[model samples]
Target: MKQSLILTILVTLTSFQRASAIPFQVRADLDSCLNSAGLTSIYPSSSGYASAAQAYNLRFQYSPAALVYPTSENAVAAAVKCAGSLNVPVSARSGGHSYAAYGLGGQDGALVVDLSKLKAITINSDQTATIQTGNRLGDVALTLYNNGGRAMPHGTSPEVGVGGHLGCGGFGLDSRMWGLFLDQALSARVVLSNGTIVAASPSENSDLFWAIRGAAPSFGIVTEYKFKTYPAPSSNIIFSYSYWSTPQATASSIFSAFQTFAQTSAPPTLGIQAILASAGAPGQLYVSLTGVFYGTKSDFNNAINPLLTKIPKPQGTSVVTYGWLDSLVQLGGQSLNTSTTPDGTDTFFAKSLMVPQEAPMTSAAIQSFFNYLGNQGTSSDTVSLTTLYSMHCEP
Candidate 1:
């Protein structure tokens, strides 16, 4: 990979020397808007870019015609209008957590509306929470826990923006019982491409409401989201089980059994995740089955006990029950303070594949894929894989 990258760079330097077109009058217009809107600076070249992470890649950078921070929706509207008038590409960036660069991918000479200044969270008497575009996941969770344990199922990390999470169908441990984050969405205030501001809800702007629920980036800039909150459950029981197996086939059988058990009798309160990894054993797989049970210990035990025969093992298992909020802090990795980096953020790049069904060929295919991954030059410790059965809207 290193050699390939070096060769590509050498070829690029030798072959490419084209300059971009710039309109002097458009630059003057943009400068006028920036001055009036109190923007810090506008960078038209690579020097003005900074490294930022979406949920995935660590080294992603966005080169914007102007990285303008607006203090108000009106100011944002003004900037958007200016960009539209000048035929400039515009991308809205809240917390910069879009893994595929959906929020920061500039075509050329694009205007980036950075909404980090819009952070705000307010809880209403009806147990509904209003979150701004810039608010992060953990921030909202902590605030909700403090305000009386009124909480909603949110993404695992705290640095992810509320806008992106809800926009992309966010889910967490409690999702097996509740639903995706968009399921709780009540309303949103959006700034359209044409600079028209509108409020969307179940009753008003219903088409836009449906679109923004799951396909937000294709729509417009969502300034704020109102979500219906549930009374935070009192206690949560987390069960961890790790298995030691000899060969890939044995581990794969366990996974297949898990799929069967999860399908027939898994309770709504039980959410399970299996991590197939090679922590200590080379070419061997360790199956870590973790569960978040949203019920009393007795009820949880009763619900999961019937399926233990499917996972016959001499491996290790641990269970802990705590207040829901405290369990969240622990399970979501906030207790280690490793949830974010030194600058309060980390990058995660992940891809997902949906398996419609499993056959002999499918199992063999997966085994080959894992074998290839084990051969990669990078340390195996740096890579992780998790699979789960998502309970969508059934409960």
Candidate 2:
């Protein structure tokens, strides 16, 4: 074990809502449609509506017209049909973890198709998994580990729904080795806007398959996803190096070093990111370089040494290794193993940028970024910058 990060920042909770509410008659009509189709519907006047309509970000909280909990594909299709008939817009909520709360329609008065009740995973003999998209990354990880020594590239956040995560190009520690979660998707069962369920694959509904893999919510709702799986790695390790109260110059150097080393020297087995966070003192920020290596502890130090040699010495460091299930838990938290609750809510404002391997950040731009942060980065407490390269290496 080694030293870890030191700078700490506390967040203040804030709630935001528009002056919008659904009409009683419309909510009642949507509920009636869902109830007639054997689905559970919660209206604004109904109990548990507030909790059911809550967004993970808490900032984009909006009152939906109706919440539909569909237990089957037919129920999901029925809800779609009912929405079409009533001339209502519909949004599907998988984990309700959208930063912009698009799952809640990104606005009010949309019929929300809640899919928490539809999580079911099937591991086939050919190392393929047919899982309901309603399952979160945590649910998928635990099930794959328990049923078979299997794994797939997914998000580090366990609370993110597979439906939304994969669609938005899911990234994880396994991503460096296995590509994205969408890359493993073999097929999907999608309910179209007109209430028809169809199978999307390369050989069938080829256009629909392509659209669903990336921009799924734009087209329709996916009920289940058939994914290609891999044998879980026997040796999984996580490492982190923290620098406390780093000056803007050193922070800029570290960023430049990481970008250069990762594009050239970092192997596919390593997935890494950096964070420049508030240190509470003026002109002070802490930076941490952390990620998971899909190889053994014996080779981890060697793989990381080049990057460390390029950057300033870290004040604290830590390295740990675990098995398949434990590694997932370590990457996230205990929620990766047994997460039933909604986890935690936050009021956040975040922006992300992906730097491709073809074009690394220029030295001048890197310095400018740090300079701006030191001078005027107080709007947010922490800024996590993740740079992913497509090494295209085999596992």
Candidate 3:
């Protein structure tokens, strides 16, 4: 059986009501309209309201006027139209996995358009897929593998919603070879702010289509996505080696060696990433090199051996091969199912920058960065720096 899970929250006005906002009676009217339009799951401040308002990041929490679940696109349109009529702000929630909790409005008093119930996966005759925005990367990966040994390049986190991930450019283990998730999108069905449904693609609504490719949440609620998929590779190999910085072998030396390997030895089929972090030991820093190669174990080892020889002595090393579905599970670092709830939710602040492939970091700059990292305390709350090197065409 197919499964669709939608979680929408309408925060109660409670102590946060404002005199300039819509009246209580108008809010009730909007609720009545949605319920009449076949939105069966409506939660006020009571009932599953707390859980409905929770986001993947526990840091930001806010309540909406009401939580709703729309089973179909028409039901979504109805909720939007009703909210517009009542002058109530609406926010769309798909998987509720936004790090900043944007699905919860980052504030309060907004109707959340939960799209979880829209989950559906249809494999077409062509090498393409019609996927509902509510599906998570994990569910999508597993489903594609099961149906036709197909796969889409997406983020490692299985809990990330297709709506947000594809909307804002997705990067994954195989991204170096296949490309980002947004590059796979062929077309989309979106609900405009005025409660109108429209199709966006290169041939139709070209401007909206281009805008939604990267900045989706700003435009409207996306109901469905049509994506190009690739045939699953027969096998994938994951390799990792961890090194502890010491008097003889320093983090600077390791980073310099990594930059050389990445620039000289890395291939398109191999995705390389490095992390400089303290492994629960104060004043002790460690550098870890991890790679994913989309090929057999022998080829992976052959490609990775020379680079390993260039780096410092390792505290630990591991290499394992996995099938397509198993590779996604390992990449996610968690077991994922078709549940609407996200797994790996925590308070974190993240930032990333893109560097030109041709320009490699200088050894002095690498040493400086490692010195700064070394100064940071090795507390549980300490922040770590992770660098990913993926080679592909500019999107």
RMSD, each candidate, Å?
Answer: 7.5, 4.9, 7.0
Model 3 lDDT, residue 341, Cα: 42
Give the Cα error of residue 341 in candidate 2, in Å.
3.6
Q: Per-residue lDDT of 234-320 in model 1, one digit per residue for the tens? A: 878988878754455666666666666555677767877766655455556666777788989899988778667776673889999
Residue 70 Cα positional deviation in candidate 2, in Å, after optimal superposition:
0.9
Q: Ranking by TM-score, best first?
A: 2, 3, 1
Query: Residue 342, candidate 1: how far off, in angstroms?
Result: 4.6
Looking at candidate 1, what is the lDDT of residue 348?
41
Q: Backbone clashes per model, in order?
A: 2, 0, 11
| Most lDDT-accurate candidate | 2
**Candidate 3 TM-score, C-alpha based:** 0.87
Give candidate 3's total backbone clashes. Answer: 11
Could you give the candidate ranking by lDDT, starting with the highest? 2, 3, 1
Tens digits of lDDT, candidate 2, 127-239: 89999978888889888988878999887777878878876667676777888888899999999999999999999999999988778888899999999998899888888
Candidate 1 residue-wise lDDT at 148:
79
